[model samples]
Target chain A: MLPHLQLGAEIEVGPGDDAAVVRLPSPRLVVTTDTLVEGHDFLGHATTARWIGRKAAVQNLADVAAMGAAPLALVVAISAPADTPAAVFEELTIGLTARAEADGASIVGGDLGRAGQLTITVTAMGSLPLDQEPVRRSGALPGDVVAIGAPRLGRSAAGLALVLGERALVRAGEDGRPTIMLRSIQDSSAADLLRWHDAPDPDLSLGWTVGRSARAMMDLSDGLVRDGRRLAAASHVTLDLDRAALAPDVEQLTGLAAELGADPWSWVLHGGEEHAMLACFAPGAVPDGFRPVGQVLAPTAHGPEVLLDGAPIEGAGFDHFG
Target chain B: MLPHLQLGAEIEVGPGDDAAVVRLPSPRLVVTTDTLVEGHDFLGHATTARWIGRKAAVQNLADVAAMGAAPLALVVAISAPADTPAAVFEELTIGLTARAEADGASIVGGDLGRAGQLTITVTAMGSLPLDQEPVRRSGALPGDVVAIGAPRLGRSAAGLALVLGERALVRAGEDGRPTIMLRSIQDSSAADLLRWHDAPDPDLSLGWTVGRSARAMMDLSDGLVRDGRRLAAASHVTLDLDRAALAPDVEQLTGLAAELGADPWSWVLHGGEEHAMLACFAPGAVPDGFRPVGQVLAPTAHGPEVLLDGAPIEGAGFDHFG
Candidate 1:
């Protein structure tokens, strides 16, 4: 038995923790897995192995931390076609090692094989040493404060648009001059949007600081409103957003509105993969490292709703298949 | 820490008992990953969810197992196109669970993505626990006794053929069908061939048994003879064989030989994925759970060194992408 097994309740031995350890009530081991497909999740040609590995490791690790679980070990499996150069595999190991080490977790085991295209799968396991039940999205009460994490939004999608010029905005802008918005995160800066687009450095610190004290919490991988609605539905409450407080990501969306000619608030409301944490807290429950965003109210006729300054926010966030 | 990090004379923080804290002496983790490429590794349409997962798990598990170290844990990344249904993923979980349950190791993490096909990537971690020195094929002694584990060969290939009507041999055999083979195992009367092929029950059994005692050991995933020559080349020795021990699965080959006059030893010496242990034991040494067969000797001037009953045994094993 591993010496950590002696750590006991923090880590339970349930048939060897193969796929997952089914947990009930207290001390639930946090787990979440995600798979990135070649054409759907990434570009088949442009994505590098190291970035894929890093992005793969970080996202799952973030999920566990988002639940306020102390990071433990990681399991990864990657699939790529046989013709892929061996160097890609080497790069992947480096990416996995770098991120895992930073998170104080190690890549324990993994699987690799030939595939129609590259696919990376990551599962993260975390130990929650809490006596109270984990703060799921279902815990928010009728009256609560809603908060959001510092989000670097639209960076990735913008970078993707630059790479895939097939976007209508890019094509429309191509006729004359460059769009100021695109030029900001352009290739010249050390803060190139492409790098973040390729590998989004998750703000795990925010999860660590605020997770446990919150009444209900969720990682915002999807756009704000979509994920906000999910939390509201989970807790059977209404979350009302202050469009006035919607920050710069929203203001900048005006440039995007000129291109797509849609409401900047729509993109602010619906752009996906922000990976921010949206949580609900009881009155006076404040945690460090969190930014207050909205409020939760009694259930409404709209049914477990989310509002943008007393009105419904339309448009859902991005979806892989949808 | 994994609770097992050994850095030469120094010990890094343990990686935790559930995982081996390995610092590969080679710098490189001698990795070779395989994806049970949906249609290629298994039936594109077969429902071996548990078996498919077992198949995918064992195939890669065997790869690391062949390296002669205890397989620590596996990272399982899977790709199934959308509309592939959740049940396939569920069954895969069963297979992964079955294999990972042992060794007190957990599946740390994984990736899932939409794909044009069903694909599985399993990357395995192995510890060259023998200091930085791993037991490789290149270290066999000339006077070593060549031996393998208990298995009736060609059962896995036969099972595949039975299920898919691909291999010529299965169509003619009554007892070798999947229905029969599965029934045998269910009845606790598993045919040695099926047992060796399907689940492969390969573990640290041989790694622990032969780590210190044997001169060389390898899992016989690729037919014994082909891999035997590899051991010979690595050890710079000559390998001689006896025809008698190769008679089990080749019994039917005799009648076919009498009809077409081809030797039965051809199949026994060259079929792959048997997963039996093939180790070279020093003279007068008997590694537990192994039987002695051919003996390793000083290199011979004869162009072909492998001989059966003093006559050359003619064949090689299966090749992947060969």
Candidate 2:
């Protein structure tokens, strides 16, 4: 029933068996899992099945990238209402396969079942390069520099604000692309921000480059401040950011923030779902395609903290339970 | 928060990072995933969170076993309501870890999220032993012996029927075990059947033995009749069973069936979730723990069929959509 589903050479035995067998590039296997639930990870009105599938695939792929591993394969388990349209399943499969193939990975196997709401759980496998070690979140040194793969942050959060705060400004187009009425906002960047939220494009290749040189690394999904705190906690260090370094990103969101009467700096620091790679590298060891955003410091009695311009930042980005 | 969770030697990097790293025993990695949803997979009143968690792990582990591989690790993704008690999560984690550890596998990593209903998705990884090849579902040939790992079947189905058919006869006890009211049937075997349905115990070691000898093998999840057809279709052969060969299994369930006014043979042939290993072996090559039940035959123009005493069996076991 699944057409255009291609299995890479690594797959020794594809689906239609008890399990799928794949040849690993190395003995070390890097694995991660993520779950996306309807009404929580996504909303029916704001996204399509294709986008949901893409988001599900990207989220786990980003985890593999964070470890500096080459993507290998993914096993997805989906549960939706029994009466869901077959077209939805087809689009979701296409989205999942397309996203995985883009990263040189394959959807080797999956399970489908009935549920009251849509849920997608993806488990992604990757392998470490022969010459490189995995960049863990615990290897950061006190003098390491904090860097980010992407130039901007908070675009997804801004896009979400546009949808939630000013619902009238966003409308689902026939092509599934959200069309902004833009009657109240004249900024062209708003459209890009909206698209970012709809579909995040994380720089996965850059993850490999950072993995080779970074002391500690992680993907920025829960905003810079929250995930930075996590990296700091894991490494037993504090991350101190230069406020001026983030000014450009904040400035980029200023126009849209004004349109919605929101703080641009808050979005830059606390907005999430960007899926950018964040790492701590030795002084002057930051790789190409990355920009320094902060520095790691020795631990203090206050435990792990993210400092903005010498002052500690308050509040976290997102907590599934909180 | 995860106490008593121990990482095996195979785990290079365990949870609390972006991903877990495990050392593979071989270049070939076997992977599978399964999802269990609330209401659809289990009922709140009839089962506990721990059973749900265990079932999720066992189903995926059985997939790994069916491939004749030693389970390496498991990655779990859970989505549940925000108001769920902390104890529920603890018990669920214990269930998952216990099941994985029983197979010498670790719960290497997991993700938790918020959803309206409970959902557990598990992805299990295993390694093909160097001395053996993967037993595919397409290698059965005419005259090969059809053998089953377990002598008994339909116990799980009988248990489910007891719960769903006569709910008033069971009540939740303080110890989490169901207390049978015993008004319908006082047979001790009926209680065993109920327990089997609640938590199936599939012998995984037998999978390794079968993998080394069987030409084609699959776990019987959807009952003998339906899955036999699948194995036959995959191998381009037909499976002709001797009714006398299945008489033992039918007799095992006869007492319970009579008490419930159900057909024993129907449950033995058509009940789902038995999770016993089914394989086609070279003539007279069945393993010690397995017993012969049928023989492979050349496919006719009508395609794959499961026959009993030379008569075609009618009806499928279970179809999620159907």
DockQ of predictions, in order shown: 0.13, 0.80
- The residue pairs in collision within model 2 are none
CAPRI category for model 1: incorrect
lDDT of candidate 1 over B1-322, digit per residue (tens): 1111122221111221111122222221323244666655655433345556766666655555555555555556677778876766766766675675553234544556668878776655444442434456656777788777654555554443333432221111222223332321221222333333444565445654464466766666667777777777767787787667666667743443333334445547776766666777788887667777788887778632566666666555665431
lDDT of 1 at B19: 15
Task: Write the residue-wise lDDT of candidate 1 on A106-135 in tens digits.
Answer: 554455556677777766655454464455
Number of the top-ranking candidate, with TM-score as the measure: 2
Q: Assess candidate 1 and give its TM-score to the true structure.
A: 0.64
Q: Specify the highest-DockQ model's number.
A: 2
By summed lDDT, the worst window of 10 consecutive residues in model 1 chain B runs over: B10-19
C-alpha RMSD over true interface residues, each candidate: 11.5, 1.2
